[model samples]
Target chain A: MSTFVGLYNYWIVIVLMMAGLYTVIAKGNLVKKVIGLNLFQTSVILFYVGMGKVEGGTAPILVHGDGAEEVVYSNPLPHVLMLTAIVVGIATTAVALALVVRLNEAYDSIEEDEILEQDPTT
Target chain B: MIAENLPVLPIVLPILAAPLCVILHRPRLAWPLAVAVAWATFGVCCALLARVLADGTISYQLGNWAPPFGIEFRVDSLNAWLMPLVSGVGALVLTYAPRSLAAEVARSRHGLLYGVYLLSMTGLLGMTVTGDAFNVFVFLEISSLSTYALVSMGPDRRSLMAGFRYLIMGAIGGTFFLIGVGLLYMKTGTLNMADLAERLPAVKDSRTVLAGLGFLATGLSLKIALFPLHLWLPSAYTFAPSAVTAFLAATATKVSVYIVLRFFFTIAGVGESLGNGAVREAIMLLALVGIFVASLVACFQQEVKRALAYSSVAQIGYILVGVTMLTVDGMTGALVHVFNHALMKGGLFMVLGCVVARVGGSRLSDLRGIGRRMPLTAIAFVIGGLGMIGVPATVGFVSKWYLVLGALEAGLWHVAAMMLVSSLLAVVYVWRVVEVMYFQEPEDAPEIDEAKTDEAPFGMLLPTLVMIGATIWFGLDTDLTVDVARRTAAMLLGGGS
Candidate 1:
């Protein structure tokens, strides 16, 4: 395989990662920043799941009491860990959204720059 | 029976108790429940630490599954020493929190607040003891998410901004860490730290492995609030409820430092490239820059809490610089600084809580003549401040002495000189508070009345005094802090203490 084809997935991961990072940094809306954070985490989950895949690998389970032939199974460890990661991502997103709701109640605006303008200490 | 599960009890106790705090739900019941669980966690941690000291390292595999296959908790001297500091502070803060939170937080919110606090404590303890790499990330998120919620509980609307910023930065940092761990797994196909240690060396030269290490360092640096990555700290600390501030300032970033130390020394054991000063030098350079820059920034902050928040970054710089020295004394210095900084900073922030509770403001201008009004709290703040400046009789001095000695031993005189200069900068910022609180006339603001301003409540005063007393006692008697620090440092530099 050519280098570009071989490393294409990682390149996609980088693009998605950078896009998420940029949205977080560049956007001023609090909810949008959270969306950016979710995007960033989603890319990471993809990277881990992608890394664990094996060519021609089937589900990581064994056939019992049958004509069981040689079967290649994808590494399941990353998949299990990513399940935890996705849960963490969900928890973070939930918390971030709750904070944004609280922010809106207090400030009457969810825009980051507007809030900073109102909060002189910032 | 649970003694066999000693390695996991500190974590399990808090995780188990946190949900109970929520289910108990009545504010009065929840406060006591949280406080009880926090003290219980400390008791369990002390037992775990004692066991580790007697037997060396304790490894408990989950569900009777063996290593490299199931999750395990392995505690040695390094984390055993840290466990009590985290949980002990949790206990004190919770004891201190009820009265303090009564004044600051709404009556209705107490139940949910304590519940989150307990879970946050569990996360810190779990991350410290876990032998699995992915387990650390999960616990990290557990702590960070809860902390974001806790900080948002502040009275001011701006606290939500602080919470939002922290969530964004923290989420990015967590993802980076996950990516790094994924890369490591690709290289070695293992997630257990001890297993990784044995398997990593063969692929140490691989680009993927190197990139993984780099990402891990970067991600941890952000979480630990190292120099340029520290933008989220000042506001978060400044705006969080006083009790939450005291709890987090004492433990959160310190746990992140423990994780970084673990990854660098334990999992990537004895590699030439890692042991060499290549990455260490860069970290050293950043640490030096952080010391001066953060300290300088701290001197000019208008709010006492914000100033101290910046000071926290500078203090972490001192600890990181010691680690980069790659010597026994340096590691010892870092370990000692971890304990000392927690004690001093926790005390300092608790004092702020007392001041803000009575005085109605914490800005430097509003704090005039506080030294006269609240004598005990003021005195505690002074001792804590002196400790921050590395005053001769305080705990900070002992840690700084070892750090400078390590630098000199390493033949890095310039770094040693910089360390002294940065400490002088600490004195300037600390003195700003001392001068404001002591010498100036009590500002004529409505909040400041000469006789009306009384001491903080007895409950708040007690924990603050305990932290202050420990700072002085630990500084004078160096037996406990220094002895454990030496053992921990030896473990980091060599295989085992």
Candidate 2:
């Protein structure tokens, strides 16, 4: 199944993962970092969805007429796990963004380096 | 019903306690509720550990559905040890949190803070006990979110920044971990860890398996803050409220380390093309680097909490070093160090919190004179610091002894030398504090106003002293920790490759 579509999907997920990681590491702004974090989490969702797909295969749920025979279907476990992961990812993003907002309110800046530059005694 | 309910009790108790804490609304009620929940979790963990120690393995199916289809909680040697460390420390830390929170956090937010703390506790405990790989990610987020809230409760405004930094890193780590789990599910068609373990060997040589392993290791390493990846840790510890710093330093990274151990030695088989010598060697190298670099950095930090924070990074290195040795002795050393470091660092952070309560800060300069005025708290700090340096008759030495023996058995003299050098470095840093406290004269003459303040309040002092006692007690009695570590190591490596 190393067709163009399959390979392209894989490439897109990898690119998204790398981009998200780069933002997290390279960005100095706390808000940007959280945004990057959300991107990173969404990349995982892409990966799970990619994994759950099959070549022309339907969902795992049985139809009325196809009952007696074993039907080839895309894997359902990744989809299930990904659903839970999506919920977790959203929770993490909400909390992280909330933290960033709090940080902005507290420090008067969302930039990490600026916050670090402020003396503790001040 | 209670007998059958034993396995999930550790998680359930704390989980139920969190919402109850929020609903109580009264600040006074929050502390007791949180403490009671933590104690209940500790008791359940103790029972579960006892059961696991008696029986080989116990799998509790949720809603009576079997695994590979339903979520399951598996209790074995590895988690049996971790369960107690997380829940027991949760209880101890909660004992100190009320007074500390009152001092550093806003009065209006106290109830919500306590609720979040309990939620984080539940999440950490759940992470250890759950057998589902995906469930690990779910619980990890649960803990991480609450931890961000708890850390941000610090009086210093910059604490919000620290929490944000931790949140970014933690979310990235969790995402990477979820991606890894997804990849594994694609290859194996299951989410249960046991089933995945069984199915993985067949696809061991596949690119998908390797990719999954790479993602999982990288993710867990970030979570555990392995060396270069530890940028978020020191500030998080330093600026966080004293109670939050102590609890997170004790439990958060230790649980992550447990996850690393579980994945590396258990889920990812430990030999041949999969586990391979290269991966172990790489981990060992990074761990050794972490030991020297973090400890040396600790030596230069002026803030007491930041120093201990750097030391925590080095301590993690020691545990990773033990794991990399890949022998029963090595793994046991790593396992034991997890508990020992938690007690030592937890106590040290608590002492710093007490100092913060008294002096309004934990800077080295601030501590110069107060040591004379607060003898009990200073003594507790010294004991805990000595344990950090692996002083004889402390739990730290036991862990180092096993680590050294493991390295020797592996014929790695240089690695053994590195551990010794790191311990010496630990001595230097600990001695820095000791010398400042005892040798140097107070920066200001003790006035009557300051002289009468003997020590921190009982709430803070009790937890610190109890942990100090544990450091000494565990140092003398190695049977329980060692036996469990041996069994866990055997279980992992035996079933691994």
Query: Which candidate comes out best when scored by TM-score?
Result: 1
Task: Using lDDT, give the best candidate's number.
Answer: 1
Output DockQ, candidate 2: 0.66
Clashing pairs in 1: none
Off by over 4 Å in 2: A1-5, A66-71, A117-122, B272-275, B448-453
Show the lowest summed lDDT stretch of 10 residues, model 1 chain B: B269-278
Q: lDDT per residue, candidate 2, B1-497, as tens digits? A: 88798888887888888888889867899889899888888888888888888877889998888887888999888888888888888889889987887778888888888888889998998899899998998899899889888887888787877777787778878877877787787788888888887888899889988888888988889899998899889988988889888899999999999888777667767773325878778888898999899999999988888899999999999999888887778878888999999999998999988888877888888788556778899999888988998888999999999999989988889999989988999998898888887777665664546446568999899988998889999999999988888878788778652
Off by over 4 Å in 1: A65-69, B270-274, B445-453, B495-497
DockQ for all models, in order? Answer: 0.87, 0.66
Per-residue alpha-carbon lDDT of candidate 1 for residues A1-122, written as tens digits (9 for 90 to 100): 68889888888888988998999999998888888888889898889888888989988897666556767788887888889988998999999999888888888999988887888675
Range of the 10 consecutive residues with the lowest summed lDDT in candidate 2 chain B = B442-451
lDDT of each: 0.89, 0.84
lDDT of 2 at B132: 91
